[model samples]
Target: MTQTLEHEEVRIHRGPRSGLPLIVAVHSRALGPAVGGCRMRRYDGWRAGLADALRLSEAMTYKCAVSGLDFGGGKSVIVLDRNAPVTPELRAAALTDMGEFIASFDGTYRAGPDVGTSPADMVVLRRSTPHVYCLPEEHGGTGDSGAPTATGVLAALRAGARHVFGSASFAGRTVVVSGFGSVGSRVAAGLAADGARVLVSDVDGGRRDAARRSGYGWVEPADALGTAADILVPAAVGGVLTPETAARLAVRLVVGPANNQLSDDTVADTLAARGIVWVPDFVASAGGVVHTLGRESEGLDHGAAVRRVEGIGDTVRLLLKGAENPLREAKALVGRRLPPG
Candidate 1:
């Protein structure tokens, strides 16, 4: 793949202690020092992990910009062998090495938890640098950001509901939540509590039982994208909405907390052609960043931080109702906040 050199800085290092590839892409520092999550996951190669880091970091730039955050965007990826055993000892070694790599940036970049990492891992990263967020509440950080993120998604969903269905209520609606993990599970529960018949799906079969136990229907991951429903919350991985799937998506609205939800920009056009209200993922997924930065970095109170997250609904409402193209309107919002290139 021909990679674009649009980012301000990019670095790849092989961890000396863990013998793993540690990739960090600083997409921009125009607003301020970059802030994004550190993701540890299996990848075919270090190059593939770097690709993901590049894409995610750019998305974080838009995410922060649209949310009115002062920070720019950056992301770190620790590539794991596809079939290698991730023993605790090895995990610690990789995390420790990553911490040291992050420390090299001084205060220019900060990291939080994402995907395979957790707040506990942020604790590990903090040992080498203070530029980590979302540490356990006991450790003085705001802790897991899932609830705040889910809250923001619900707010956006309500705005989207009003845009598409002429009401802001989830009542009597059939909703499908893809990916029953931290953020996804909370989104599912919130929708179910709002009187929406929620169906959940996960790539992990173990989550199926948990979904059912929560009084939600379970769909296999293979059948999730095509499952008919009023809305589809893609709380899982990216690339779920492609030209192929967008052609057959059975939902009227597509919104969630996933990053880089579209395979490419063209997919958004396809969704529009299909009359689907696809809220831009960068706009929909800024809650975690907003809450974490507000509480930990900006010294906002808990209630105030939550209020900022809830403001996402207003942002989405403005984007959906104020323009003919919400995606373009959203990018305009980001562009207005971002420094000139």
Candidate 2:
């Protein structure tokens, strides 16, 4: 937390034919390879895209390190106009840009997917560079890591439940989930399947209806926290849990896959004081990153990857067990691994 901007790197990438979109590199820590996802977005502009990528990548480093993963954090953002057509040529160029950028960093950074991206994109990325991971295997794919990420978030939620209610089981318990995107949708589904009565919300009415038809309880997006649930999972976006909003939060646990979930450590302390068990974002949301890593050109087959990720339950348990300070312990794990200098 004390570190400044001394080590971060921001770079612009270009291809021969046009459209290289900006790629920002934020090397927050270097315990190991800088690992993060490539998020393609309709950024406001080049500057905005770069800033988002830099901050996100840096956060990933802290998240991974805190979660005991030996990966330094780095994030990539592809600036694109929202209206940009996903023409085959444009898509190919995007993948090529990824390759060019990865070629620059080499071992220092590993790439995965984030918002506005998917395993399918990874396949395209493989066209330009073999650095892609988490593809669907048939296209010589490695598969999507979204499910594993949801699983990790589920584990953290279970741990948080114990801290709040003395049990991790959500049977008959009420829970609300906001966002309903890739991570959020899976989280809601997982919670409901585990016996938690779920209240779901999303800006997209179609997604909301889909959840309801899928048997998930439904509610307006604004009504999530007011649903009188045992847990509130905000899987939507960062800064959603601000001081004012958090003060109004009436839930026993807050665990989700959203990065920067709390905005700041003050929120962490606030949650603790309110008797709301907050599983740190980095710890809870790392399944996807780790899962992506499992599919790396470094070889861990599907079965092996599944076993390794499911085994993360132990790490989550340890972090939650009589926690002296889950955050501190996780951070210490990172500090210990970094060499003396």
In order, what lDDT does every prediction score?
0.93, 0.74
In model 2, where do residues sit more than 4 Å from their true spots? 1-3, 6-8, 14-16, 82-89, 295-298, 322-329, 339-341
For residues 1-341, write the lDDT of model 2, one tens digit per residue. 67656445767776454475758586665667777888877867788787778768867876776655667788888778766666767766776777667766765776776787787787766666665667776876656777888888887787778767878888988888888888888888888888888888887888967887878888787777566778988788877777777788888778888887766667666766677767767778888776667656447776776666665566667766776456666666556766544
lDDT of 1: 0.93
Q: Write the per-residue lDDT of candidate 1 for residues 1-341, one digit (tens) a residue.
A: 89758999999999998999999899999999999999999999899999999999999999999999989999999999988899998899999999999999998989999988999999999999999999999998899999999989999999999999999889999999999988999999888888999999998999988988999998889999999999999999998889999999999999999899899988888888888999999998888999999999889998999999999999999998856667889999999988787
Per-model TM against the reference: 0.97, 0.88
Candidate 2 global TM-score: 0.88
Rate residue 271 of model 1 by lDDT: 88
